[model samples]
Target: MTSYRWTMHRVYDATGNDTLGPAAISMWWLARAAAEETLQGSPLASAWLKLFRSHLSVDDPYWFRWAEDLAQSAELRRAYSGLYGRFVARALLSAHLGINRFVSLKRNGVVIPGSVAVTRISKGDIPDWIAWDDRASRHVLCEAKGSLTSRDFLAPGVPKCVKEGKAQFDRVETTGASGKLYPARWVAATRWVTDHRGGTPATLLWDPPQDHRPFSEDEAARHREAMTRAWLDSIAPGLGWRDADELLAPDRSRMAIVVNAEPGPVPPSQDWPELPDNDLPLIARLTEVARLDRFVAQRRPVPSDGPQDVADLAGAQSGSQTYQASWLPRPRGPEAKPHQGDYIAALATPFGLRPMRTRADFDLLRRAQDRARDLEEPAMIIGLPVGMDPGAAPAQTTWLDGAGISRKQDLAVFDLRRVKVDLLDSGPTG
Candidate 1:
């Protein structure tokens, strides 16, 4: 756009070499340095960067600095004018700023936390590069792709978000040069490429009209202007300082339902003197009485043959009072077993669980669960419910509640054929 005393031809004419056109090579090297410099934090540092003498090797002398002038010469500019501007923008952006982030643009206090590139430009993919950044909040999703111009933005699989975009490059770190990093922003693409990552149809860049008609040029300018506005709005929220946690509050609230799976403990009878209006208690009492009556009738003691025999029979069931209720009938069918529900097992820690049972006891029991061999340890009592069918074997259960106080749920029948093990005696109670 501006005249310069040192032109492309002057640089290329100084050397007689050809191939790897000087302009193309210059732009390539400039782009690489620009990208690295931007990453290091200063976009303008490239202005002072000098090419190494070795760069004049057979790789093509016409490619660097000199070739750049040829590509932009009045003779060539009319034929490839669009490419000239795009190439300049790409070099400037790469030199001073990174992709996917607007820091290249010199906006203050903006950072894309997890951005990473997954593709490159040379694969005929058009987007010189692509990057991804996740949404900090459910309401906001941000990602960006950049190219030399709108035409270079499209790739067969590229998505719509980056089809054609503009970028303001900023300083970033790099491993090259003297390792001196500073803040420098650079001007880059005005067109975007796509939104999607992975798979085909990822992005499409707008193409400049081949005819270069006046109307097409005007339309292209208008579209480019609209895209800039959209880019500003898309990245505006990220630039402002706001609490991401506040935006995430609703997600936290919805999780409370997971804890409500179990009803809380029945409060102390004294604290709740008046019973709940529900008739559940009445039904429970009647059920218990009927069960006790049936058990007594079915388990009539045989007439004793003598005092010695009676004493031996009594010994058949040996245990302290704490384990009296551990022997209960198990359920019928193949499914008969003790199931430790999540809430039921978790209750032992808060309430004083049982006599001689300290917090240490619960910890030991939990560890034992992991090792199959440790399951039969003496501290836990194993028994089956009284009514459990003989065909349906009862489960070996460990009592967590304080020493078998005959709670209603505790006596629920597992099956009829269980060998009751008394917790106190550490022996069978039949």
Candidate 2:
């Protein structure tokens, strides 16, 4: 079998150029090309790759060469022997770094141990890198980069560096001949690491933007150093010569994404007992999705998965305003005071409810009261205005008399200042 070795060369350089390190960019192309091969026949992956292309420097001719090389390699008849080890290493880095939280762990705390004899996804598993069993509780899946001086992992936001320094990568570098310094070329390039076992792909995103705020250049360098070593250490445990059967050639047609990579739209109506109370918000969301789906269906297929894509479509639809104004009746009601003007206007508007003033004004409050009483629960009203003479004096309670519905005496009133009342039937107009 012929061997293909890809060495990182300085393709582009400028003291001020912060685009990507040459090694990083080249590695990115290789990893991306390999990642794309996983779904060669998939139209979905093709479309996604098209979207992915926009993120790259479109004018770069090397990218085209990289793509061509990947396509041609897919047709190779012999086993990819020499490049096998690099590919597996690439996959492990991709699996861990791609997650929101990125970290790697050691097995039995080894220092520069020889590559294990294992090859293939089964031995490596998916999301190839994971922390030691004890470390899982200490950190999240997200990865953060920072430098450590002595015992302290240094960064600005933190008051003090991690004192315990139990992180695994620390020991390996100190004992190994390579030491802690990450190969300059390895740290410079971006790679699309894949978890063949788990089938998830994430960019081994460790590079800072060259101008990271909050972090000094020295700090950023240290952070990158730590992350690079962590990634290298992750694949070290299972490293071995690649087996022809283990490597998967990129498939242009078949789309490959992480398991449950996309989420479905939430259902509108939930199952309820006997009579169901409508969930207006859920219904509104469902209705919007339906409307947008109908529109997109006519133009192109709406992916059953890809929740974010669906949301983007819905957001675009919602951003546009649709006015539906109707004729309003002439003002023939009683004149409103200065304060009442705002209240009156709000009532006239759509989706507006008038404020309850007098106890009798709580007529429509029956539903709320019924709900509260049925559950034998008390309710409190919030943000009510303070009115005049609220603590003046108590008024005699009165109501409709026998023959006709007429007030007999001042309605029962108490000082609202002293006690914090849980329930208020109604209150006077401010």
Candidate 3:
């Protein structure tokens, strides 16, 4: 399976030491994080999504092959290295440290009040990304660097990158809504190599002890509103909306989302569970293969088992059932029958967003849409195969075990140790 091995470190004065855990992360989650970071509300979101869908692989060494091919062109190689570096940094910070939302330094500097004056440093010295940590109630800054060079060269070069990133952070400043400076942490993430088995990403985090007030309730509200807008904008295309404005239109009758469930026997409704109402709008579980036909046509490298292997990996086994469920909006005043168009039947699968062609498939979705219109309060329909109990756990499979990781929906993470950490200054082991 394709994955990135990562390690975290803390730098004190002139010395650096490894922090607790090192691990491997699935490319699926990394690609998802990259999409959130760069494609939200972007004019080119569709194109970027297509690119990611084509390149991402979970059960093959496709990334290494892609990187090797790109290395033939110096310009493309440089661009890929920089972009991949930021993606890795975002993935690690989000999955490991719980910092999810991110805005480029350029965007944040302009949008946040009073940031322009505080971040007037030279363009080259600005940090790469800015994020808020609701758990810690503090802002986080990150500067990411990447290289595709040999290990001999990277041994010396990685520390220099970290040093320079720290210098950039030293020049940056930010403030919360009350006009007082907000507490912040700094991180410098470096992926020293790409296209090689030995390459592993590393981070240099400098979180000094400091006392500062958290964002006020009003400040948090505004921040949440902005982040929510960005999230909606990012997934608008995937949800078949023209844009965020159209998706958020007050008069719009239906809200649509595409959920990409993991490959395994379908679990009962109780095991799967319904998402909370507040999270419904943000509940898109995108899969790596948005369309299998297109994926095969591109002739991307895969395991020797060929297209069937790809199908299994993408959760599209033959004879597998597609299930649709609808959650109807609450009614008001005297109850009147909802219009036929008012109902929306969305499925939980990784397949392409297309109409079901089979007679049974068509009838199931059509009946679901009709039933939703008859409800008074919000209601959900859970679809299960004929033989399964409504409360049974999903059947286990050897696929995940073969990959050497625990499954969390489509996400898989594995711990690692003894990975090398080359720092300029020697420090006592932590």
Ranking of all candidate structures by their lDDT, best first: 3, 1, 2
Which tens-of-lDDT digit does each residue in 1-430 have in candidate 3?
Answer: 2333223222221112112112334343454454444333332322333344344332223112232323458886677666766766676565445554465655325354322123634445677766655555456666766665523211222355666766776666665445646435445354443344443333433343344565677556566445434434444454445554655564333232111223322233211223346533321111121112211111135456532112111211111011111111111111122111111112212122322223344344434434434532111211111121211222221122111222221112211110111111222112
What are the TM-scores, per candidate, against the unseen true structure? 0.15, 0.17, 0.49
Candidate No. with top lDDT: 3
Model 3, stretches more than 4 Å misplaced?
1-21, 41-69, 113-118, 150-158, 192-211, 216-222, 230-246, 250-430
What's model 2's overall lDDT?
0.21
Best model per TM-score: 3
Candidate 1, residue 334: Cα displacement in angstroms equals 90
**For candidate 2, lDDT tens digit of each residue in 1-430?**
0001111111111121111111112222233323222212211222222223332222222221121122136433112211322233332233212211123223333222221111121222112122211111111111212211111111111112111111212223221122232211111122221112111111112211121123344443334333333432332221110221111123210111101011111122111011124432332243243232122111235566632112111111211011011111121121121111001000000111323332333343344435544653322111111221111211222111110011111011111111122223223222
| lDDT (tens digit, per residue) of candidate 1 on 218-325 | 333332333223332332222221222321233322111001111112223211122236632442343232221111111234345421111111112212111111
* Model 2, residue 207: C-alpha shift (Å): 20
Q: On lDDT, who's better, 1 or 2?
A: 1
Order of all candidates by TM-score, from best down to worst?
Answer: 3, 2, 1
Better of 1 and 3 by TM-score: 3
